[model samples]
Target: MAKIFSSSLGGSLFKDERFLYQEFVPERLPFRDEEISELVFCLKPASEGKRPTNVFVFGKPGTGKTVSLKFVLSELEEFSDRAKCLYINCFEYSSKQSIISKITNFLGYAVPSRGISYAELFSKFVAVLRTKKVLPVIVFDEAEQLLKSEETKSLLYDLARLPEQQKLSIGLAFISNDNFFLSQIDDRIRSSLQCSSIPFESYSPSELKEILRERAKYAFNEFALDEDVVPLCAAHAAKLGGDARIAIDVLLKAGRLASREGAKKVLVKHVRASFTQEKPVKVEVTSNLSEQERSILDLLKKKKSQDSGAIYDTLKDKFAERTLRAALAELEEKKLIVSEKEIKGRGFTRIVKLAGS
Candidate 1:
């Protein structure tokens, strides 16, 4: 009994932080009031049993494309009972059969384990909707992946053509990571979709700061995040293409690092440590010399100084019999190594050495 009580107490003490890293996304969609108003108008009872608007929402990752479409759908559902809404992440269901099966499953239909093709599944889905007299709004998230696959793209084309062909009211929302997703499609497929395109842009530093601040309030107690930490995180994220996901990841990592160290509040030191620890391999390679580059530098240290051609030949002989010329140029560009132009017998030879050496 005592051991059970101790285990329960330990579990309670290690509770997860309640703060949300992503803010209330519904409020941050840039210049989307016109789009929101149009969607709301489409959900009116007068438009019941009629088709909802077909929308194509595209943007770079972490630009709130999925969140905005989801926000609008949630609001529309609340405002009207005539509309039925479903959202599917296409990354999980990249194939046509898988997507159709998920749709049927979401609508409370029993998905057959096998022997059901995508076309048959879609037919049942449309039949159920027509019989129920409900205008169904289906959203495909990460839709660029679907557009890239021929079978999935053909399924979407057929679905979009349904209303015109069978006189059934069905609306589609395609959420992609870029505008080029549409351009990559067949013209006939593109024309059949004929959607009103909505563009989502990456957040600015100030915008990202505001978003982080709002999220911090929910994720941590007041005064937990230092004033400078939010701005620093925002700047870091802005430098990496204004990725909100990265901003939130940095915030979470910093906060956890602070907590693990038993600090009263998050600080720049903790943020820096977390950034360094979680840094990607490519970024780390640029930050710290990779194993191969370190080996090259060690070899360079053996010689007083060497020209590019000589270094390349030496590395090819010593290492994997591969040239080191490209690595030399990159290191020179990074200022990790220095290059000198010296007059040889004829043309100038560029000698390379460690930056300080």
Candidate 2:
């Protein structure tokens, strides 16, 4: 409490700070009325116990697609009890098992994290939906993240075929920033979804100003922010694809910088400085690293390149083959290490090394 009041920046600069968060969906969105209405209509059928038409929403990063869809779903849940909304981020849950497990878990079923076959897991998924007698709407955020594997195609095929297979009421909404997303997926998967599509236009400079001012009124003290701060943030963000998130993030970062400097108000200088502060990497954090992964990286850091069998031998006492393989896969995914499979006479030898080590 003491620290909260001791700074010259005041107790806080924000009224409802959550409005600036990526996941926060304001009750009323600025400049997105049309998009919101379209989304609401897209999900309206779910309330009547019918499988609503699937929707594919695409736009560049920081557009309002994700938030608007979420806002619609939130409102739908408020008045309807026959439908449920589920959101999944493909970048985080990329694997088939991970995706299936998340869906089943969201449906109130529990199964082992591994060793659960896709057939069995999906069987459980359909059974739950059938028994619940409720419409299930799934929003796949960054659907393009799943396009790298055939399993994703399989997943989409199964979901699109679910109604015919089980006669269950289910809906899928795919969101992607890449304009070419449709052309890249399997033709069959694309044909099956046949989604109602909507594209979010980029925000203009004037539009960004309105968004920034609106958020500022609720995000900061009336006089604690300089008159030029919002426009500066808006202009900077507008130049980079008119991302409202960038504008909001800049404003939030400026406030923190002002507080850190013991300044009474956030100013243009803080906004400029905030732009240089690199956002933290979200893909891999040291704490998320498994013991074996950390050990493997450490070993490679000292021992340099080593064949997979030799590396496995070095840590066989502490880790099992499955754990080692899984750790290697994660490390490779993180780009902390690189593995190359070399064809031998009858098989292949896997070589591992620290990337650029």
Candidate 3:
């Protein structure tokens, strides 16, 4: 009988594959020292048992916003017992109730997931915070997910007013790819936030190289990557959008491809081959869009093009006009769709179509 598995094995390419994952935070984040310093400056007050300035961090994806803030949060919690940090992905906890529940749970309270009104849960959280008297610094990543509806918007309002209304000193940080995220919020809420802003620029090819080289050190074994592999991956990702995530993804895929072929090293050809196998940057961007944005894109895909009014009418049953307009503007900003002014019978209307259609 044939053996179930071959006795011989080739040299594996990866030393520790987890280093390539998005969730893995490195000990040192390359090319983001200035940003990290600014985060520390903004959040330092919490370590002194004071209300830290709320911060709004904006950047194109893969520019190190989330990871930098996370690193600082970890350091803050480690440095001082006065500060407690909680990180929440707004995409996963998009609702107001869910966010409050998470905070409650993080504060060592295990509230039931269901059978509690948002008001009750929120009050319980406030009570917990007041009793604990610890300054909580909450980081909301992908914050645009919280702007989809008025209900969720109220959550931001309440959070911003926590100090004034509940007398709790809390620090809030929002990370998003959208620069115009604040414009959609109510003026009162926006004023209450008074958040300091930090913008992260897209990584240049050289910058991406440094990032890839650092990640590769832990992700792959010695001599596992050919001389040109890192440069090739960086150049490709730079051309695509200067996204470090894409560059790392390409590197990981190339390593896997080399291992699959029993090749000792990941070569330029392996990187090139992985380009077709890896998902395009647009797909990655689309996967991160909110449900409303995805629905709008799907509609555009089917209709090819539609006027503002028509698109609104078709989707009005599911979303309000305000929500639709915001989602459309966001899609255009993301370059997922294109909008043009066209002449109607009486006046001009905007024509919306999928980008590159």
Candidate 4:
């Protein structure tokens, strides 16, 4: 009876919602200028007919690691034809053969799907690279998965040794959430890579606000968002891990909630409601913390607020005061705790407490 396919909703909140999507790469990434410059430095050599320095980019999830590299890769392609950029997710192509086959296909060389030996496939891939005279800059996203298998570990070695073995210019970029992944890799592979490491720090609350505001300008129409909505979303995601994805996703959900109710604007209530739907993401953030960080949070749970000096005194036997201070700084960065300076008699010290207290 009702028009099944047609909706009667009016006053939509979104103008173009794709800006909030993970797959959508914005032309300019806010708060990632340093990381972008470093990526360009590593990949720039390819444009000059020299082998690009291998780079390992590590950071927490949704900290703009993958997106920054993707943006750089796109710019590099536009600037020069000498660099052949190929992006691969190691979770999908975790084997040596599969990855090599992918590179071959990416270079416009097709091989028989079956009945071809890996050595033959690889030889063909190398020949194509030599003939094309383009430096292959292969980005392996989620590269931590590749280290789990001996098969894939060997693939790293082969790629690293390609210059010496095949006399071809090749570049490798690895993206991972685990900061210690390079330490787990083989020494020879590590030595050959001469890898430049770039670390992406979690966004601070203010930085997250800037990011959300920029995205909102593109995603929502004029006056569609309440003033408080971006702050609430940023604070929530900052508390978790300063995950930009969480902040953007909450904004998108809140906009949809407003549209579903035929509301004229997305308000703070919609953002709060969206928070209830992201408990799983909160658990994931908690589970991914280091044991030391978790221990600090557990200690903080017993008190409403504790002096930073006293906290160091309590955990001094297990950790040095410097290490404890660093842990507290990290916790504060994640918005897991808040720290403030206080005067203690003749001197000032920091007072620490769980966030939102």
Candidate 5:
């Protein structure tokens, strides 16, 4: 084989920087200083080995809820050993067992992936905290789903009472996108949590522009992007609800598009392509339908109308005939189509037709 060599990711517009990624936690979060101080004050009690009030942080997506919380926790960990921070995204891990397992894993106890009960994991978690004498500051992002899951009452109740019953300190920080999520929570849980609530508003265009400017300094070369490029990206993302990550993404995609054409500088045209051409919206009547359902729809569009038997015969090689039948039922249930029964011979046949037919 020829000799291989590693090379730098050169001639690229980006700096391989953390500021461009959603998960990066910068040393100081700009534009969120007021909210940062409030969160720190709320979580401050935990550093003194006392339980802080549970907190509900509500905001639109990309409003810096996760970033600010992690920022304070970084400071908390650096100065003291009294509190350990654990952050979980409920959208990805919504079940009681999975959430509990996340806590356990974070605390340095690795539980097996399967064959373990949540009660067993939770008990072990409590025992570890009791032994260590350190507070576990749990931040649940996308907390709306957890509140709505069946496990909500039991899990929250047990967590709230853990401190009193066993004298263990556990703090909770819940982050949600829905403004009314807190109001929808059960009263008993609300009372038990007694959480301090904070809401984050979407960034204004100017605020988003400032944020993009800060990141661009670290993310791009000196003359890579034009002055108008950042504003165009910021304006487009602001229209999409002022998400900081979205702005960064717009810049990155636009920069790459310019680079692809060997252009020396990113421009407003590149930014527009970043918003539209890079990822065009798919306008379809079958938008929310599953792939199989959409495939069946495509077939019906080609074949006009066919009985269930003929439709299945066409798609039988792709999947089981029963699967095709299930897709037909789903389509009818979604009102994407109508099926009528008619006797063909000794058996009844259902003829399928698109909704508009």
Candidate 6:
């Protein structure tokens, strides 16, 4: 094993930091102070015993919608002894039954195995809340998925009406990356919700740089990271829609890669390699490429042309039991090969060529 060393010069920058870099998101959200204040006002004591507000929050991914909601709920919980706050990520618990089960579990109630509809479970949930004299505050994360499901939509409808039936103070918060959620909602349900909507926009380059700087202090030792890294990472993420998560991911990966190479500080090469490695790929297509397509493409240079089926059959001997047809289709989809179909003796055969060719 190779010995690792920290750069003497970089070691002095981030000493004795206790706060988490990515975690401990500030109570006052960065660049979202106004939205935080508005949410806080809606959850204030005057609104406690009254019917709680239905809130719809929309933003692109990494805009702090979930974190801001959690922050507001934490504050509400601290002040109100009579209210209950529950957070659910609808993407994970998408169905009504699963979401209700989670709610029951959160309340410390035994989740029944069967024989309970969403309505029944909700009624039971309200009964439990009434017995405890606690108002319910529900936050649904990834709520766009819920809006797409009829069962979830019905569940939301019932939740909105809970206050009318049981006099329970119910606040429903829906967090979504998709702005189309509002338009997809049924007219009657939409009318009943009367949800106050809030939109979270992507962070600007300066904002992303500030966030990355804050994260670096907690995630790395003082002076472990290069000064240029934060700005570069921010610029890269800005090109891809200003995703904070991607910026953090890039920073973290670059640090790890540097550490692996026994380097004292992360370099631009490390960041570039990390960014390239994280490119998304279709798993099935990548895993099952036809040997012919792979071989022919490997041999050809950019703008090179080749016969499709003939090349495919030549490679077939090397990969017995592999389907050439499927490989050609996959290659075409990937734009690695371009095929032209022409009539042969019995049927049409595609004349394949390299994409650039």
The numbered model that scores best in lDDT is: 3
lDDT of 6 at 226: 81
> Which 10 consecutive residues of model 4 have the lowest summed lDDT?
4-13
For residues 61-127, write the lDDT of model 6, one tens digit per residue: 7778888988888888888776678889887888998887787767778879698877788877777
Please give, for residues 1-357, the per-residue lDDT of candidate 3 as tens digits. 876456333457889878999888898998899989999999999998999999999977778888899899999999999999999999899899999999999988898989999999999998888888678999999998898888889899989999889878889999998877887678999999999999998899999999999999999999999999999999987765577887998898888788878897899999999887854767888889987898888898999989998989999899999899889877865767766678999999989988656
TM-scores for all candidates: the values are 0.71, 0.75, 0.80, 0.79, 0.75, 0.71
lDDT of 1 by residue, 1-357 (tens): 457644322221113354443544534454456656655554443246576667788765666666677788787677677777888888787888887777767667778969977668888877765667567788888787786667987888878788778887777888876566678778877787777777777778998888777667666777777789999988877765566776777888888778766777888987888777654544555567655577667767898677867766766755552336546644643445656668998998878776545
Best candidate according to TM-score: 3
Better of 5 and 6 by TM-score: 5
List clash counts for every candidate, in order: 3, 0, 0, 0, 0, 3
Q: lDDT scores for all predictions?
A: 0.70, 0.80, 0.88, 0.86, 0.79, 0.72
Can you tell me which runs of candidate 6 are displaced by over 4 Å?
Answer: 1-28, 280-357
- Lowest summed lDDT across 10 adjacent residues in model 5 is found at 2-11
- Point out where model 3 deviates above 4 Å: 1-10, 279-357
**Which residue ranges in model 4 land beyond 4 Å of their true spot?**
8-10, 280-357
| Residue 66, candidate 5: alpha-carbon lDDT | 88
Off by over 4 Å in 1: 1-47, 280-357
Which pairs clash in model 4? none
* Better structure of 3 and 5 per TM-score: 3
Q: How many backbone clashes are present in model 3?
A: 0
Worst ten in a row by lDDT for model 3: 2-11
Query: Per-residue lDDT for 1-357 in model 5, tens only?
Result: 543422323456766555677787877667998888889888988898789878889876778898888888889877679888888888788788888888888888888989988889889888777777678899988777776766865787778778677877889998877666777777776777788988887888898898888888888888888889988888876765577877888888787788777677888888888777533332444677777788788988888888989988887788788678767766764446656678999999988887544
Cα-based lDDT at residue 93, candidate 6:
87
Candidate 2 local lDDT, 1-357, one digit each (tens): 468755554445666666677777777789999887888788899987777989889876677888888888888777788778888889888987788888888878787887779899888888777678678889999888877798887888889888777776688998987666777777877787778888898787888888888877877777879999989988877766577888889898888888788677888999988977733442336568989999998899888988888888999999998789768866754546656669877999988887534
Q: Model 6's lDDT to the true fold?
A: 0.72
